[model samples]
Target: MVKQEKVKVKPLPATIIPPTSWVKYFKEWHGLKFPVITCRPLGRLGNLMGEYATMYSLKRHYNVSVVMNSEFKSRIKHIFLNTSLPDIPASAGPFQLQDWTPVQNIGSLYNYAPIELAAAGLLGPKKFIMKEYAFEMQMFHQFREELKKEFTFAPNYTNKVNEFLSNIMKNRSSQLPDPVFVGFHIRRTDYKKFVKNKFGGHLPGTSYFTRALTHYRTKYPDAAVFVVASDDLQYARAELQQYQDVYFSQGFSAGQDMALLSSCNHSIITLGSFGFWTAYLAGGEVVYADVTTKHDYRFSRKSFEKFGLDYFIPLSVD
Candidate 1:
């Protein structure tokens, strides 16, 4: 057996609104500590960023241990770290939560969906006296810089995640891949109004995607464009039929999806959680559609900016 050197992580002040099993998973799988930070669901973005940034910023910070808080004993924990800025700052506008209602002024519906306005708003009166928007932006600016240092240097993705990646590369997993190997995501969970009216769309990024695939085909005619999507694969497969190796994955466990995503050499992401997480784990070059829809530009710009423009290929204008 290969002797593994244990990592030391600093005792985190508190973990933010992370997924329930996040701390426990970190402890058992990675041996990291993540004390829960009990902030409002849509509040404390600054504190959240600070906590992860500080903990991840240093190597050998401290050895961490956390108790599992999940239903399943063998359940694996998945940790998602996000610190991105929206194109049009929602918190900067006059739409404060106290003033806006959820009925019609759809812009302020849910903070994190279109933008993390609710979380930004949670900065509070006394602390956010001058300008909450500015504070949040600066906070992200600092946080991004800190994360860049950590993400680039250390293994931002967990060890179990890496093992999962290895398994997928060897093609020994439940989630089977189709020929082309295309990665895509459906962000229909939100956009309730759009869902009702059937007007909401995939950020108008489909066109950008077709063009990217066309370019990829020109270079590597034999390489299959494997796609990982949150929605049904039939639609995308039917549309993108011309590719030589086009494939999509059936809906599977988060760990399964994450593993499959990391094994891909190239991918495309939508403007939603599923896609965001997949692309991040892919650790490969990605292509993003330049979204023109309301509030979508936030994710389009943020994902590219947050992860690194180098990893993304934006949809073309014109």
Candidate 2:
């Protein structure tokens, strides 16, 4: 019998397929599954910004559902009526998926390892629960314009706020030129004790306000009106009485105060996220703060840097 010669087959040339579309790439990048981020944020109005902003940032990569209790809804609805975020009932059960992950802080969510793993479709979680205040300003800085659209006030609130501002302006002397409206937020009451414990003597003194007031007056020599929003109205009233054209916003609710603050052309803020957000959303020409006060771990210099707020004029309590 004749032996047949062995045949050898050569491999075909490597195919040069084009890259996939962005939509397809995005889907596959996240492991062929879209993520859902559920959050139950707790805090006062200012603290809520950290929560809302974090969710807004996450919206870029996942579906965000905020578990807003009735109290939370009542507090924020007027100011942020068009939140555009989907809501889950406060009583909803835990996300029962085996792949659920809990990110308790902003640092963990933005850490290099997690981000890299997520991009490579290796991160196992399909749903993430954010239980802490992601107060790091960087979380939402990239989506500021988007956040502005999402957090627009309801029309009724906006109209009322506008009328209130108009009345304030109208009350000024007609002989004087239209004065610049400067919002001042003195975060006292609990904040005083907080500052004493956290910042020692770095708490902003009465001199800080007077100095800031004088600075603005010099800068806008013709006219300047300062609207004071303080938890301690009497303190603001007493401290600011020597200055002219200062109005204390004593009777308004917290939401109303925030709206009024955001309407100002400039601001003097204190050492809290609440004050930080008011100045930020207002898009004021100038924002003054006492940066000498040290921040707790939850916030830091990087937080201010992330929001481009390092430029805030630093007032000295001394």
Best by TM-score: 2
Residue 24, candidate 2: C-alpha displacement in angstroms = 11
lDDT of 1 by residue, 53-90 (tens): 33232211222221212211112223333322111122
Candidate 2 residues 35-117, lDDT tens each?
A: 44545557888888777776665555433233333444566776787776655433444334343465564354323223223
| TM-scores for the candidates | 0.46, 0.75
Q: Which candidate has the top score in lDDT?
A: 2
Candidate 1 off by > 4 Å: 1-36, 39-182, 186-202, 306-308
Compute the lDDT of residue 124 as modeled in candidate 1: 22
* Candidate 2 stretches greater than 4 Å from native: 1-34, 61-75, 89-101, 106-123, 198-201, 293-302
C-alpha-based local distance difference test score of model 1? 0.38
